[model samples]
Target chain A: MQDAPPSLLAVDGLTYAYGARLAVDHIAFDVRRGEVFGLLGPNGAGKTTAIACLSGLQRPAGGTLTFDGAPFDPVERPADRARLGLVPQSLAVYDDLTALENLVFFAEMLGVEDPREAAVAGLALAGLQERSRERVRTFSGGMKRRLNLAAGLVHRPELTLLDEPTVGVDPQSRHHIFEALETLKAKGHSMLYTSHSMDEVERLCDRVAIMDTGRLLDTGTPAELAERAGLPGADLEATFLELTGHRLRDEA
Target chain B: MKPRGLLSAAMCIARKDLREFSRDGVGLLLAFLLPLVLVAVFGFIMGRVGGGGAPMPRVDLALLDLDRTEQSAALVTALLASDTLDVVRPGPDSAPWDEADVRERISSGEDPYGMVIPQGYAEGADLILLRDPGRDLEEQLVLMSLVGALFDAGGEDFAWEMSKRGLEASGLPPELTGRIEAVVNGFRFAVEAMFDEAQANGSFDEDAAFGGGDGADDDGADGDGENAGNAGDAAGGNAVGMAEILQLTLPLELVDVAPEGRDAQLGYQVTHAVSGMTVMMLLFSLVGFGRSLLIERDKGTLVRLLSAPVPKSSILLGKLLATFFTGLLLVFVLFGFAHVVFDIDMVSRFDTLLVLTLVNCLACTAFAAAIAGWARTEKQADGVSVLLILTMSALGGSWMPSMMMPEAAQAVGRFTLTYWSLRGYQGTFWYGQHWTDPEMLQSMGVVLAIAVVLLALASRLFRTRYVRT
Candidate 1:
């Protein structure tokens, strides 16, 4: 009915491999302006590989990525790359640096106007303002996760790529992070969120793409995907199970 | 990217690295204090062994006097009175230091040096020098001391006898030998007459005899030219100078041609210790800093850096800058400590030292970055870097004098940065060469070339392994 929000990032025929084995097999998705897009998969389902390709840490074998109505290749079009912010799955903040120092360094890297001011603002946004001066090495996993998110957000790019941002965090810190993401959404920022948690994806993502074994299985809204799975009114977990199956992914 | 922007990013990264390095107290101690302590220990040991104001210690020589003649006794007393040798002789009751006993002593390594004055030593028999091999420098000193003792004890007689024996032993045709012996005898006669005149007169007319009566142009000319002047004076019916006559007959003076104020042996060992340790530890500390890249990759922070909006080269350039600055500081600190503790004259050659040190640090920084970039893991980096650095240090004469190595090993040492670095410092401190000296420039050029090659390799490795993925 209503026109889908104009796509800010569009991918087509994206492919990658680790040697002979395919890790991202011609999969495609889009994150429209001002909305959260989710990529859902099991442990070895290539979600992180897709994120790595999008964030320029990797070069895909075959793909045409479009950002803001222009062809985007991070290596060739670094200005387009500047519009992206990537939060890797690992806790990537420097342990020896204070929270404020880490944020400021990232801000400087991203060419923020005033690194200290942006760092302070990022600290407040992550709910880590009180401990900004303390080294990240002393922080709990949850606190570090929060600061990690804040570090990624210092430059406030148009699209934030968050790969399993809630991993290893306490439920309270997860709630705090979700609240921060919600605030960014309220501010009209876009995000591409990847995770294994169906509930979090159902709650935060306006659209979802389910992948398995490096190939996209489906993409739809939660209710639409549930209905398509023959479970109307069911939660996203039921639809996820139906699409990706119940096999133990770690063993695979 | 703009140059300013690139420089800004690089500085930002370098600052971050320096900050992190500063926070690791143990690392700081290892990087800074360890070299100082090692240098101090090495400096003290080298000073005691072969340095200090004295160039070498007094050598102990076993003396076997088979002649037991007045000339042999005079030789023994002169050697004993000399500063360079401690003459060890048999006691009155002991068997008189036989050649067999001394040879056995040398062969068994109980003593490494011995000398035998044969029964005909006073009658033109060759004196025997026996020693275990592998002590060439000490052997030279012993030879010099023996010659000086001979000159002191036997004077012109010993000189004439030794000359005649040398001429006869040369295996030359008898005709040539006879002519040489005749000329030598004439020169000896002239020298004896000059000595007698000098002994009779209270003061010898040195200028009239040696300078051909001009007295204005002596000015310490060469022996040949001074001999010509003495000839001219003699043809003019003037007396031949004693020194010129002796110079023609026996040119056996031992002169140290080291730089005016510096002690050659002491300065050489000091420079060897300082530059060797400094260059070796630079690779250690700089590569240790470069290993931060591997640490960041393991911690996943490298991915974040790649994801940031900066030219990828800026990161590596930042590491290079940080490493270079750190290495420079470490070098200056070590040298400063050496200056304070060992009294090396660094201030006199500060400019030249700084230039060489800057180039040396750059080469080391490039080497560090290349190792860090090429290694796939920290463990691999550690193992490879240690192996290469230690090998380079040893081959480059860091552990011992390159001259002590076999000729081929010394040739191989020329390829190592440590050798060139030590050579440059030796040029500066020992030979008193300035930075613009050709040898110093060659050292800088070779080191700079090594840096360029390593930097290019590092760039390729970083691109493949970290940047492009």
Candidate 2:
């Protein structure tokens, strides 16, 4: 009825290459406000490169990225990247810092004058309020994953990019991660989550894009992707294999 | 949250990095402990330098006995008998080196002091000291030994030359005067030889002898009480009565003051050691800081910061500032350690020392930043940094004095940052040069300029490889 909240981001004709090997070729996508967009691909896919271009960490060979109907040029200034947040697949937080301290530091980095309150909120969001004083080095893998997520949210950017946030965690930890994302969604933050796990994607993502090598194959809702693979009633795994192929990707 | 400025971001980053560094227990231990242990080891090896002066300290002299006359042999024997020096001569099978070669050897610190007796040295007893200009104490000893020998030879020449002329005009028979003159010259030689013997026994009270005092005795305390004065008086009184016919001798114009006053610098070995050790430690610190850049990228923190509301340059500046402060802290700690443990005079020229330290830290940080920018991985950065520090230390006068090094090696050393640092330090502390000296200022400026240029280059070369799959 409200025109389904305007698109918070727009991307078109994005291209990136490693040497002469093209990794992301003329890909395009959009993320609506307060909606979770899933980016899925197998290993060696262009998912990471695409995310890099979107986050302003790498320059695209060609294309444009717009945020909130405004041109967002990462090459211009750091403020261009201020509206975006990226949680890398690897743990990026300092291991020596305590949970609250980590939150405080990240919050301050984003220009928060008093980070204590935000840090506290982040601790709560990550379900680590009780372990606020503990160093991340001593944290469990799940705890670190949660803290990592907490750090990205400290700046409270309009768009958050989550890259394999729960890849190596236990099921219980995975549940915690899902809950955290759901909470962010409830707070009206758009997310771009990358995952290989079909169930997690099915449960959280409103729409998904599947890519391989350097090109996006298709993008749609869970049922739409299933049908796009020509298996109208099949699950995401069948659809993913149908689109991305069953052959294994090369390993270095 | 409000958007942040670049400076604010840099501060936050610096604080965070410093905090992280502080928590690395082994790193902190090595940072603090390594310098202290190194300083202790060097100090112990150098041992305590001599304090106060010892009268007529035993010196090592390289002597070339070119003169083969009996008189020349007698002079050498007198010198050996007068134990002020352990006279070093060429081995029997060794070839004779020229006076120029001896001078070159002494200047290179291959030999401390040397003298050459010319072919006709028996004629007038004129000797040339083959030495660099900066040999005050040594020069005086050489002069004293020469004076003792020359007085004997000159006294004989004076008596014979005068007896052949004046005694004949006094109407004495020439034969009779020659015999008397021979007796008088022999007695005079005996008298001078007695003084030489007293010197050899270390019982010569040289101060009491001349009252020109302490020219012969570097310190007055070691000589036998009144013995040198008594001997000089007795010998002079005896020689005066018989050697009335002897001709007057030339003035003993000895150059006892070092032309450059550089002898004092040789005593500041500890200061030189501290400067060198500090340079090496600062270099290690630079390596650590350089590796931190790669580590940050590997950990994704650098990429994450790029997304923050601050310029990309701010990220580099932030890390550099952090490293600069860290390096500054390490430098202070090391100097403090040296001061407390080894009694190195770090605070004597506190202001200049502080400025040099900051400049060195800045240079080292910039150097490390460039290495980080150029390297593709942490291991590459580590290896390159270590190799650089080792090579620079070895070639840049850190392990030894540049003065002792060969001319060509010294020339090459001028290109290393460590050379500039040591030069500045030695100039300031050892040579007692002021900070306003052109050479010192130039050294500082060059190091600072290096920092600026390298930092700019590093910033240009640096690009995050954040999109790795």
Chain A TM-score of each candidate structure, as shown = 0.97, 0.96
Model 2 alpha-carbon drift over 4 Å, by segment: A1-4, B47-213, B216-266, B341-343, B464-469
DockQ values per model:
0.40, 0.43
| Predicted structure 1, TM vs. truth | 0.78
Which stretch of 10 consecutive residues in model 1 chain B shows the poorest summed lDDT? B227-236
lDDT of 2 by residue, B61-143 (tens): 77777887887777677666553566877677987777777777788887678878889977665577776666675766566
Which stretches of candidate 1 lie above 4 Å from their native place? B1-4, B52-249, B260-266
Model 2 - which docking category? acceptable
Model 2 TM-score is 0.75
lDDT of candidate 1 over B84-150, digit per residue (tens): 6777777889865567899987888776689898999777687898877877778766776777777
Candidate 2 lDDT, tens digit per residue, A166-225? 978978878888888888888888999999899888889888999898888998898999
Residue A199 lDDT, candidate 1, scale 0-100: 83
Q: Quantify all predictions' global Cα lDDT against the true fold.
A: 0.83, 0.75
Residue B150, model 2: Cα distance from true site in angstroms:
19
